[model samples]
Target: MSILYVDHEINNLNSFKATFRRDAEIYLAESTEEGLKILGENKIDVIFADHQMPDMTGLEFLTLASNQYPSSIRVLLTGNAYTDEFKRAAGKGYFHSYVNKPWDEQQLRKLMISNLR
Candidate 1:
């Protein structure tokens, strides 16, 4: 399976990649623009985007990506608690999952594989 993860924090990007690289084909990006480019060039099975980003919030990017790649599962990650934005995204079917920051690797891995299945 292919996983696309976008985070504005370079350290988070690196850490995520390090944790999950062995699981599948992993694509990492430090911005929404780079994430979009990766999505364009790849047939991603899953996507993870940070809630707060520079160019646009993860909500915006994932919503757009969901429109363009309906088959891919989209997940939003955030350091803050769930808010109205998440409720809207999930209600609209733009988000398949919402994960809090400092995610548990085992749970996340299970989430990814389950989504693929």
Candidate 2:
């Protein structure tokens, strides 16, 4: 399976790729636009976006992605506590799930693996 992870932080992107690269084909992007570009060229099984980004929020990025790649499992990564917006987004099926930033590598790998199956 292949995964696309979008984050503004270079360290976060590097860490994610380092953690999950062994489990799946990992693609990293620093912006929503770049993520979209990667999406256009790849067949991604999962999409994970950081909630707060310089260009667009994760929700906005996932919204656009869902419109184009409805089958890809969408996940949001945020450092903040779960808020009403997240609740609403979850209810509306904007994303498949979320992960808190500073994610536990093993748990996140499991989540990614489980969704692919």
Candidate 3:
């Protein structure tokens, strides 16, 4: 499975690679435009984006991804707490799940495995 992860932090990209290097083909993008460029060239199975990116909000990215890459599973990872309003807002897009930052590694692994299956 191919996964695309977008984040402004280089450490996060490196950490993701270190954590899931063997599980999937991972591609890292620092900006949404770059992510889309990679998407145009590869068959991405899933996409995870940081909500607070400098280029665009994760919600906006997912909204665009909904139209451009509808089949890719979209996941938003943020440090903010969940609110019904936020969930309702994201409902219009293709986001499959939301995870808070300081993410639980085990839970993330399980979520990815189940979704990829």
Highest lDDT scorer: 1
Q: How close is each model in CA RMSD to the real structure? A: 0.9, 1.0, 1.4
Winner by TM-score between candidate 2 and candidate 1: 1
Model 1 segments more than 4 A misplaced: none
Q: Which residue pairs of candidate 2 clash?
A: none
For all predicted structures, in order, the TM-scores are 0.96, 0.95, 0.92
Alpha-carbon shift of residue 50 in model 1 (angstroms): 0.3
Query: Model 2, which residues run further than 4 Å from truth?
Result: none
Error of 1 at 58 (Å): 0.3
Candidate 3 or 2, higher TM-score: 2
Arrange candidates by lDDT, highest first: which order? 1, 2, 3
lDDT per residue as tens, model 1, 1-117: 899999988888888889998888899999999999999999999999998999999999999998999999999998998998789879999999999997788878989988888
RMSD of 1: 0.9
- State each model's CA lDDT, in order: 0.92, 0.91, 0.86
